[model samples]
Target: MNFLWSLFMRKPALRQFALLDAQGRCQAFKECNQPPVGNGWVEIDEIRLSWMHRPLPARARVSPRPAQSSRHQPLAA
Candidate 1:
């Protein structure tokens, strides 16, 4: 059983990278299965002087405020 499982099982996938342009705008954001394309890697002419990291920025979140309750719903006790 162990032999069969090991043969079929593969390694985990790597997460994609996110980048920011010169103007600090999010130019590309996608979970790429393959390596980065042309002028995508670091120290390239296309890439501007911006920060690049494995994880996304904290400010990249979109948490809107809860909508006002038009109807008063009963709370479940």
Candidate 2:
């Protein structure tokens, strides 16, 4: 069905995996480069994920301030 296909492809609805850390708390993720902790998929009681990645610092907007003013003349020997 087209509805089913859409759900499967939808990144928000599709959970790549969940992992339990040593602290016993479970973390939900959209994806992971490494294998999940349990090595299997299981029904989760709760899930949380941020759909958007934290925006990276844009080079265009960020301009570093000049460390020192050029008005000071250098010492002569």
Candidate 3:
């Protein structure tokens, strides 16, 4: 059982890679099973992993104003 499982279930699926242009747009996609074509391609999975490690920019914080009373005395009619 162990031998059969190792032979079949141990293998992982083919990895998918995205080909990007100079503008960082995806032009095409290719899997690991396919032969390499042109350059400027990156692994789709790596993109998400890299983004998770990136730091976010600081944003300016705004202070809230004090509350004002809206009640007013009635005027003579």
Query: Whole-model Cα lDDT per candidate?
Result: 0.48, 0.40, 0.50
In model 1, the runs with Cα more than 4 Å from the true position are 1-7, 40-77
Off by over 4 Å in 3: 1-12, 33-37, 46-77
TM-score of each: 0.32, 0.23, 0.38
Candidate 2: lDDT of 22?
45
Residue 76 Cα positional deviation in candidate 1, in Å, after optimal superposition: 64
- Residue 3 in candidate 2 has what lDDT? 88
Candidate 1 local accuracy as lDDT?
0.48
C-alpha root-mean-square deviation, candidate 1: 13.7
Backbone steric clashes in candidate 3, count: 0
* Candidate 3 TM-score versus the reference: 0.38
Number of clashing pairs per prediction, in order? 0, 0, 0
Candidate 3 lDDT over 1-77, as tens digits, reads 99988888756567656666666655565668443577865555422333332331112111333555598656886
Over 1-77, each residue of candidate 1 has an lDDT whose tens digit, in order, gives: 99999899995655344454654445665454444675532222232234343333545433433666899888895
Check candidate 2 and list the clashing pairs: none
Give lDDT tens digits, candidate 2, residues 1-77. 99889788945443244444444334434354333455423333233453123222222122423456669867995
* Model 2, position 10: C-alpha lDDT score: 44
Q: Using TM-score as the measure, what is the rank order of every candidate, best first?
A: 3, 1, 2
Q: Which one is best on lDDT?
A: 3
